[model samples]
Target: MAAQFATEAGDEPMNNALWRYALQVYSRPGVESLLLRLQDEFDADILQILAVLWANETALRISDEALNAPDYLAWRESMIQPLRDRRRACQRGEHGDLYELLKKAELEAERYGLGLLWTVLKDSPAASENCGLQGLMLLCNSEKECRELLQLAQP
Candidate 1:
């Protein structure tokens, strides 16, 4: 299911740009660890954070309503979270192959989730250049962590 959506999503300019930005930024030093820490300690939604950051970079606006869209929430809770939980539960030494597969699936689920976010966010143009930053503030609670993400997200 996710593969099918991902294949189609690749054809969309917005999806391609967002996914590329996410992959590039996430591969940077400290980004993966920082995002995981935010998820574990702050209950942050990594996909939402990435989407907001992508919007900011591209000067697109993601509204609060789009951030809390019911379908996106449902997908995250039902698909992404469970895969993340299962992946985290499996010890790499004990179930290395299974763990790797689970991790890949989780990533795909997240990619699909980003596509979902883009569907709504595309319609809302940014009123100002800082709209993405404004949305990020609403999603992130800790100023320090938010700053850290911003620094890492920048090329």
Candidate 2:
């Protein structure tokens, strides 16, 4: 299933360790729909959430400023958002091929953003404990919703 989203060979290998970790967490039951809601309704940045998860796993602290860095937002607005808009537009019609293409491009854009985030924290040391839940709470609409989403992300 993950192979469906992998970048082609000689394409810079976008599916790095952080991306793999995201796939693993995202594949957990109920996570997909919850994440979709977080994205569509709450304006949550999925890449930021994934980066925070990676930071928690690596014991790196990601400040709110870093998570909301201008570069990241600019990338999302220019790359991912346009693709997402096209994909959503295509979803309203019989444009399956176009939708699929847009979806792939959006995923690549997201991977690129995640890679940038990983680069920012590459030299940091691991923490003794994971702070994923706290990170999720910051992105989620409420504590209850965050807790529910965390439960879904966990096996």
Which candidate's TM-score is highest?
A: 1
The residue-by-residue lDDT of candidate 1 on 1-155, one tens digit each, is 21232334445633565676688889999999998898888898888898888777766667788888898999999999999999999999999999999999998998888878877665666556676556777887888888888888877
Positional deviation of residue 59's Cα in model 1 after best superposition, in angstroms: 1.0
> What digit string (tens of lDDT, one per residue) describes model 2 on residues 1-155?
32332322433336565677688888888878877888888888887877776676556666677677777778888998998888887864688788888889998898887776655555455456667778777776566767777567654
**What lDDT does model 1 reach?**
0.79
- Per-model TM-score, in order, reads 0.86, 0.81
Clashing residue pair totals per candidate (backbone < 3 A) = 0, 1
lDDT of 1 at 98: 100
Cα lDDT computed for each candidate against the true fold: 0.79, 0.71
- Model 1 steric clash total: 0
